[model samples]
Target chain A: MTNEEIRDFIQTAIAENRVMLFMKGTPEQPACGFSMRTSAALNALGVQYAALDILPDPRIRQELSAISNWPTIPQLFVDGELVGGCDIVTEMYESGELAQRVGVEQPQHEPEPPTAEAPQSAPLGVENRLS
Target chain B: MPTATELKERIESALPGSEANVEDLTGGGDHFRAEIVSDRFAGLSRIEQHRLVYDVFGTEIGGPIHALSLKTTTPEGQR
Candidate 1:
């Protein structure tokens, strides 16, 4: 496939998938501790979503970073839009916003205090061990 | 390198009383594996369950802690 075609293919993957997280690891193995947290947040929400692991190829990550300008793993995409990073998801969760976006309930019925979360910090903007 | 205790504490502090096991899976001080059980996951789907764990760490996910994998179960677990 031509370069443009390849790019289009990737775009299709993003656009067609309702929930996409371009993470470093799989849902079962998050490859990074932060990714694990992000993965957990989504799981807690109780939504069926697609997960793409960017660990298989350096070029895949490189191309995605170049195309999206997101220099980090665990990049989340909802309805094909780049929905910030891990911190962003956490923030949305606290505000009862991400649940709305993803079409699920807050699931915060736990007896413990709802420390839920709010977009904290994503090592995304930090220096990284580039793949 | 974060000890298993530190990892467990950090995870518990974030999610609270959540039945989780945080271990240094790689002995690299960075790689971790967390298997959590909680009522908070009662009705949520599989993907959603995983996201909650990642949300706690936020971006620190790929930072000081390099890799993290997860397995989440409801208080009742699989049917």
Candidate 2:
């Protein structure tokens, strides 16, 4: 697809999904540390989200940044709004705002600090239909 | 390769009355973490506040600057 088409595709994906993530790789096998931690936050919250891997096409990243005006990857969009990248997402998750925004109860158990490694528990029904 | 000092200077100069503490996270000069406090950030969402800092770098963000982890707060909100 051309750059214009890719941008449209990204915009549509964001509009269609209640919670959308544009990341470097799939949630199960993230290619970047930041992407891993961002997905982990959504996973830990048990929020079902649709994720798109931007690694497959450079244009996807280019157009995604254009559409979101966010320079980084692992961008989380809630209800068609940019929630932010890993740092903001992680901060919100730790503060319970992420769960609140996604309409989920913040898990009572303390979550281990986000590391490069994927969380041990499997993500709850993460949909990768955007690929 | 931009140094931590350069990043700090850029941010401080770009946003008047801002205090920025920048650290090279990996000692690689590319990845950094910056904590910024400025009245300019007042009433802005986290996304908007980060974008203000990001606009200072433009295309350089994903290019020469690989990553810039940010923590921003208004002067009154600083903890």
Candidate 3:
């Protein structure tokens, strides 16, 4: 699909689904770790949501990033607005904000064990470790 | 691929007077986490704040830079 068509498709999906996720894979089988975590957060809450796999067409992600101005997959939209990506969603889920935003009660489950509250505050090193 | 320092420089230069701390999360040079403190982020929402940082990288994001996790705050919001 052309970029315009892709944008329209995204708009319709967002408008139609109260809770929509533009992820790399389906919730049942996520293609990326970030996607898995984000979807898990929603599932843990037991909130019904719609998922669209961006892997099928590269243009879907390209248009999504362009229209949302959020250059990331696993983008969540609530009530037709961009909520955020994994980190933000994870933080919010931990803080109980994500449940409220999605209009669902926080799931009754094991509370996240208290630890270092700061997210990725420590850096391993400056050198590229991938090499 | 942009090194952590190069990415940090780009962030700091893009948002003048802002303090940026970058880390190569996976050591693969693709995934990274950044902490940015600047008055520019003071009034923005979380989504907007993240977008500001993402805007600096533009199309490079999700391409050369596989992931850029961000933590943004204002000077007053510093911990």
Candidate 4:
């Protein structure tokens, strides 16, 4: 597809999905730490969202940035507007604002806040299991 | 591979009157975490506030500067 077509595709996706995520990988298996955290936040909130993996094509990332004016991947869009990248999403998730925006109940159990450390711990836990 | 200090200087210089604390999260000089406080962010949404900082970097953000995690706030106590 031409660059123009790619941009059109992205714009349409944003307009169609109430909550859209343009990330490095799929929601089930995020390739980057930031992408993982962003997806986890949406998952924790239990909101339905459509995710597009930008890693498949460099142009996808380029076109996305062109449309959103956001430089990074793992950008979340709510109601066709840019919500933000990982930091903003995680902050909002913890503060209950994300839930309000999505119109869902923030989980009552208050799951552990997603942190950069959470991803690092997985490898350490794996090493410990091998020992 | 911009150092944390460089990132700090750039952000501070660009925003003027903004306080930016930057740390090289990986120590590799590519990934960084920055917390910024500025009057310039007073009336902006979180997204717009971040964009102000991001605009300073232009294309360097995802280029030489791999990732820049940010937390922006207004000096007036708004987040």
Best by lDDT: 2
Instruction: State the lDDT of candidate 1 residue by residue for A14-52, as single tens digits.
Output: 887787777767666677655666666777676767776
**lDDT at residue A27 of model 4 (Cα atoms):** 68
DockQ of 2: 0.92
Predicted structure with the largest TM-score when compared to the true one? 2
Candidate scoring better on lDDT of 1 and 4:
4
Q: Kindly report the docking quality category of candidate 1.
A: incorrect
TM-score of chain B of 2: 0.96
lDDT of 2 by residue, B1-79 (tens): 8999999999999998999999999998999999999999888889999999999999999999999999999889842
Stretch of 10 with least lDDT, candidate 2 chain B: B70-79
lDDT of 4 by residue, A57-84 (tens): 7888888998899999889999999999
Expressed as tens digits, the lDDT of each residue in B1-79 for candidate 4 is: 6999999999999999999999999899999999999999987999999999999999999999999999998887797
Any runs in candidate 3 off by more than 4 Å, and if so which?
A: A108-131
How much is the lDDT of residue A88 in candidate 3?
88
Candidate 2, residue B4: Cα displacement in angstroms equals: 0.4
Worst 10 residues of 3 chain A by lDDT: A122-131
Candidate 3 structure quality by residue, lDDT tens digits, A7-84: 887888889888888887666667998888887787777677878888877888878888887889989999989999
When just chain B is superposed on the true chain B, each candidate scores a TM-score of 0.84, 0.96, 0.94, 0.96
Kindly indicate the candidate among 2 and 4 with the higher TM-score: 2
